[model samples]
Structure formats: structure tokens, C-alpha cells
Target: MTPHYTESSLRQPRTPHIRMPPFTGKEGWETWRAQFEAIANRYGWDEEERLNQPRLEGAAAQFVFSQLSPMC
Candidate 1:
């Protein structure tokens, strides 16, 4: 005997998709940060919590370092 699957089960469930708007300058970064903070808040995440952990010193640090890197 084979297990049965419902049409709904076979179909992917719909989920809310949140995307940040494009940034053009310092204002853009602030806008993006606001959206990020909102999403974090929705999931009960504290932006400051990560600060409690040891600072990243390798490839992991680049994630944030690159974001703040000066542009040409």
C-alpha cells in the first residue's frame, strides 16, 4: 500500500514575503535599517543581543564590516 497526499499538502503554502526597498544614500541605509528592525521585532529579536556575544574576528566579521565599508 502507498501513502496518500492531499492536493493542498502537495502544494506549497502561501507565506508573507517581506522585502526591503532599494537604498540610494545615507537616508537609504536608515530606511533599510528601519525595515530590518521591524522584521526583527516581528520575530521577537533584539538587535542588541548579538552585542553580548564575542566580536566576530574572521569571515563572519566581514558581513558587517563590508556593509559599512567606504564607497569609491
Candidate 2:
């Protein structure tokens, strides 16, 4: 026997598009942008830094590697 679908099951829920919190004003935006740049620069790596690394061989290693990679 086959089960029948209800209206609730037939429709997917809508997800609201959330806007990121706006910068309060120009000064606030500049401050935030500077902070972000500092953090990114602290973590960013050059290609040469990556090339010397050993190859990852497992899922866990790959996950950690991804977290360190800029692509994340």
C-alpha cells in the first residue's frame, strides 16, 4: 500500500534571506573592516608556505588542512 502526501509534506518551508548586520556608519565600517583585515592577515598563508607541507592522507587530516587553507 502507498501512503498519501499531505499539504504540509508537499510544500517546502521558505528560508528568509538574512541581511548581515550593517555597519553603524563610515567610521564603524572602517573599524570593522580594519579588524577583519588584521584577522585575515594573521591567518593568511602564501603558496610557498603550503607547498612545503606534507600530504594529508585521511578525512580528519583533510578537515584540519581545510580549516588552515584560505579557501575556507
Q: Name the top TM-score candidate.
A: 1
Q: Write the per-residue lDDT of candidate 1 for residues 1-72, one digit (tens) a residue.
A: 999999988754232344444333434455656776676557554445322222344444565568677553
**lDDT (10s digit) by residue, model 2, range 1-72:** 899999998653232232233333433546755664454345453454323322334554565556676653
Worst 10 residues of 1 by lDDT: 49-58
Clashing pairs in 2: none
Q: Model 1 residue 3 lDDT?
A: 92
Q: Give the alpha-carbon lDDT of every model.
A: 0.50, 0.46
TM-score per candidate, chains pooled: 0.30, 0.26
The lowest-lDDT stretch of 10 consecutive residues in candidate 2 is 13-22
Clashes of 1: 0
